[model samples]
Target: MNKTCPNCGALLIKDAWETVETNDNGSYVFKSYLALKCLQRCGYYERADQNDQE
Candidate 1:
């Protein structure tokens, strides 16, 4: 089942999060993750499981 915002009753949306990091040696690392967000933009969000399980 999909998740809904408790305050607004709107369907939650799935989105991706990504970031890049660099070290003093000029090496860089990339990171990404999934998250669920409230469609109403209520500042509600949670990270998705690494296995993509609900």
Candidate 2:
């Protein structure tokens, strides 16, 4: 899990301690990994989204 985005200094979440699965959909987790991003409508999140596709 990441506390701040590597590309940008943005908080991934409000919680101090958070764990995220790189690929989480519905009730399934495609892969177990850590990803950090800013949800403030930036290219970073988009890039991450695209990377997830691969």
Candidate 3:
């Protein structure tokens, strides 16, 4: 959808990551989020908003 860096117009790259944590009952919980980074390395990065479409 024409994703680009606001500062340099470089193409934006999507990265997904997840983490696991232990709960009080010893059950594991997982969380995940999406982030964007400038492909040209212009130091532009941001996490996708909760309502943002992938």
Candidate 4:
């Protein structure tokens, strides 16, 4: 799967460290292991973590 910026449809590359967060369900969630850059405009990126993969 390719990570892209929410603002712009730019491909996000793995530029930084990976971030993980634990939900209330006591399951660990992997947010993003990559950095997304917007070429046209600056925006936010939102994605859902796969519980099975985590």
**Candidate 4 ranges beyond 4 A from true positions:** 17-54
Q: What are the clashing pairs of model 2?
A: none
Give the RMSD in angstroms, all C-alphas superposed, for model 4: 7.7
Where is model 1 more than 4 Å wrong at Cα? 18-31, 50-54
lDDT (Cα, tens digit) per residue for candidate 3, span 1-54: 668999999998887657699999999999988878789988787887765544
Greater TM-score among 1 and 2 belongs to 1
Regions of candidate 3 where Cα sits further than 4 Å from its true position? 16-32, 50-53
Provide the overall lDDT of each model, using Cα atoms, as 2-decimal numbers: 0.80, 0.43, 0.81, 0.53
Top-down lDDT ranking: 3, 1, 4, 2
TM-scores, one per candidate: 0.56, 0.26, 0.54, 0.32
* Clashing pairs counted in every model: 0, 0, 0, 0
RMSD, one per candidate, in order:
3.3, 10.3, 4.3, 7.7
- In model 1, the Cα lDDT at residue 6 comes to 78
Model 2, position 30: C-alpha lDDT score: 44
* Worst window of 10 by summed lDDT in candidate 1: 45-54
| Number of residue pairs clashing in candidate 1, backbone atoms closer than 3 angstroms, sequence gap of 3 or more or interchain | 0
Across 1-54, the per-residue lDDT of candidate 1 in tens digits comes to: 788977788887888767799989999999988987789898777787764444
**Candidate 4 per-residue C-alpha lDDT over 1-54 given as tens digits, one digit per residue, 9 for 90 to 100:** 766675566865434345788899999987554444444446453333453123
User: Candidate 3 at 30: error in angstroms?
Assistant: 13
